[model samples]
Target: MSTADVTSSTNDQKYEIAHLKLVPKRHIGRMIAAAIVLLILAAIVRAFSVGQIEWSYVRDFLFAPAILDGLKSTLIMTVAAMGLGIILGVVIAIMRVSGNPVLSSIAIGYVWIFRGAPALLQLMIWFNLALIFPTMGIPGLFEFRTVDIMTPFVAAMLGLGISQGAYTSEVVRSGLLSVDSGQYEAARAIGMTQFKMLRRIVLPQAMRVMVPPIGNEVIGMVKLTSLASVIQYSEILHNAQIIYFANTRVLELLLVACFWYLVVVTLLSIGQYYIERYFGRGSKSITASM
Candidate 1:
């Protein structure tokens, strides 16, 4: 090509490049949406701050002796119930996955019944079990009046633990199932007993998959303990109810309960994050490298 023609073509390209828009178009709609969201949030905050919710009562009763005692009860119940539930869940999960059909069927039935029933109803039933069975024990061996044994605490534990076990069994079973069949075969080839294999190999690996869901269940159990209040178990909600019933500071008392629940749930969530991180170390390292 001629020098003059090449120069003219280059000048035309430069002119076009200079005239072209560089920046992407602004999203006016998104900006408008964000403004709308911020306004709504501000409005909500203002409404709650000025609403009939007595903040003074919430502040005063937040750490009151009764509320603290109720909070303690809630924490204790949650821990006990979750612990018992985990133990029962492990056994039931094993049974569900076992070779024996009868064992599997029994586990299935337990899960079905407990998971299907309303937790509140289960609590009520346990609390009022004396009505159904005035006495409970081995006929010739020993006997006790149901009312004597099934106090609010016992009833709450039985109801929450048993019900939680049903959900936890499924969580555990899912985690167990996530393991590769080859892992089982390898353990067998190494002459490890099924129990040893589960304890040393399968469970450790499966826990990576299980920890998050189990953590969630633990948090859920904390909230579920509130339901025990229906049976006169003095959990946070029940204590709040009692206070409100006496003083008629219903919303404030409820806010107190809400505050404690959020605090507990937040702590549990933090713990769960650490647990998840610990279990996820191997996978995360590999992912990061990739």
Candidate 2:
């Protein structure tokens, strides 16, 4: 290009750049909203600090032996119930998607009944099951009193686990269906059996979809264990209730329970984040490349 033409282009670019003002926009409304929220939060904190609640009771009972035992029971029940739910969910999900009409129908019915009922009502039913069946055992090989066998723990676990299975089955089925049709066709083309395809190819892929909801369910299960308090299951809330009943410090005991619940849920949330990231690595890589 000629020197005159190059010089003219450079001069024009400089003129355009000079006229481009980079003014920052002011968020007046957002600033006002944030200020208002802070004020409300400060008021709440002040009120709680000045309230009649005996904070010492909360501190004292936070690590009490009874509370610790209750916390242990809560954790155990959560793990056991989730394990049962996951196993039942996998089987039910498989049955739901199977070609056999009878199996599919049974799975559908199971989900309908369990998921439709209130969890509290289900717990009540299980706790009181002995009224309907005074004796429960194998026909002749064994016989045991239903009341003796159906403790509060057993009733709570069965109610929570079975109800959780219904919800989890739907989550699993959705995860399985999220796999591409081509994946199934490709597996069959390679002479892979259905179960083998699922175990080796489908389930691994589906884990990415399944992990989130299942993690949420785990958190929900932790809170749901509190419902067992109604059945005299010695979970955290139940023990907290017992303490308050004796000491007449209801709010303080409740605060202690709340504190522990928040701690447990927070820890579980961090674990869920890492697990989701692990399962989502492939998707994240593909996204980054794009």
Candidate 3:
């Protein structure tokens, strides 16, 4: 080609400079309206004198070490329950997907019973297990044989975590299902062992799918920790109750508990966003990095 021809072609090349596009001004109006609504809510709260409580009293005894003790129990129960629930969820999820009819049926029943019953009722029943099955010593097989291995705390853990597992099992099963079947076929075609395929391929993929719902469950578990209060587990809500009972400032004391809960849930939600983003980055549909 001649130099003139090449120069003409190069001159035809185009580059588009990107500019910041603005949203409609009515969107700003909506935002201002939202701000006004929030201000109105704040005014209502103030009008009800919710924040007029003597800050000194709250600072003094409201947040004493004993109050913090309740928060500690809340954390302990939450961690323990979530840890146990995840384990149980994995087991049940696997059972749910198993080829065996009996195993799958049993897992289904387990999920049904727990999900059907109220968690609070379950907690009460567990707490009273000590009364139900007092003791049964076996011959000489073991030291205690059928030992009286029931405590209020242990019972509460079982009730909470087991119930949570039933719900989480479904979440996990959905996650596993969301993974493309072709991935499994490919894994099998490659002669990967079932265990190997599950560990090396399936679970990681399922976990990515599980992130959003599982994050919700984690936050729900944090709030569910309050249920342990029925058994006197001294969680955040329990502490708030103790303070409220002492002073009868129910709303204000409850606000303290709500604050802690809101803080924890907010942090968990932010963590969930990052986790979901991490998994989302793996999506094939996404051409651009987030």
List per-prediction Cα lDDT, in the order shown. Answer: 0.94, 0.93, 0.81
Q: Per-residue lDDT for 177 in model 2?
A: 97
Candidate 3 C-alpha error for residue 234, in Å:
1.8
Residues 1-290, candidate 3, lDDT per residue (tens digit)? 99999888877664332455876556877899999999999999787675577656555655678667776787788888888888999899899899999989999999999989998999888877656556545646543312245555676788999999999899889988988999999999999999999998898889888888888888998889898888877787887888788888777777677767888888888989888877776686554654
The full ranking of all candidates by TM-score, starting with the best, is: 1, 2, 3
The 10 consecutive residues of candidate 1 with the worst lDDT sum are: 281-290
Candidate 3 to truth, TM: 0.80
Q: What TM-score would you give candidate 1 relative to the actual structure?
A: 0.92
- For each candidate in turn, the TM-score is 0.92, 0.91, 0.80
Which runs in model 3 stand beyond 4 Å of their true positions? 1-39, 48-52, 61-63, 136-139, 142-149, 284-287
Tens digit of per-residue lDDT, candidate 2, span 1-290: 99999999999888887757789999999999999999999999999999997888888999999998989999999998888899999999999999999999999999999999999999999999999999998897999999998999999999999999999999999999999999999999999998899997899889899999999999999999999999999999999999989999999999999988899999999999989777776786657956
Q: How many angstroms is residue 146 displaced in model 1 relative to the true structure, after the best TM-score fit?
A: 0.6
Candidate 2 vs candidate 3: the lDDT winner is: 2
List runs of model 1 lying over 4 Å from the truth.
1-11, 14-21, 284-290
Candidate 1 CA-lDDT value? 0.94
RMSD (Å) of each candidate, 1 decimal: 2.7, 4.5, 8.3
Mind giving the per-residue lDDT tens digits that candidate 1 earns over 189-281?
999998999998899888998999999999999999999999999999999999999999999999899999999999999999888877776
Error of 3 at 112 (Å): 0.7
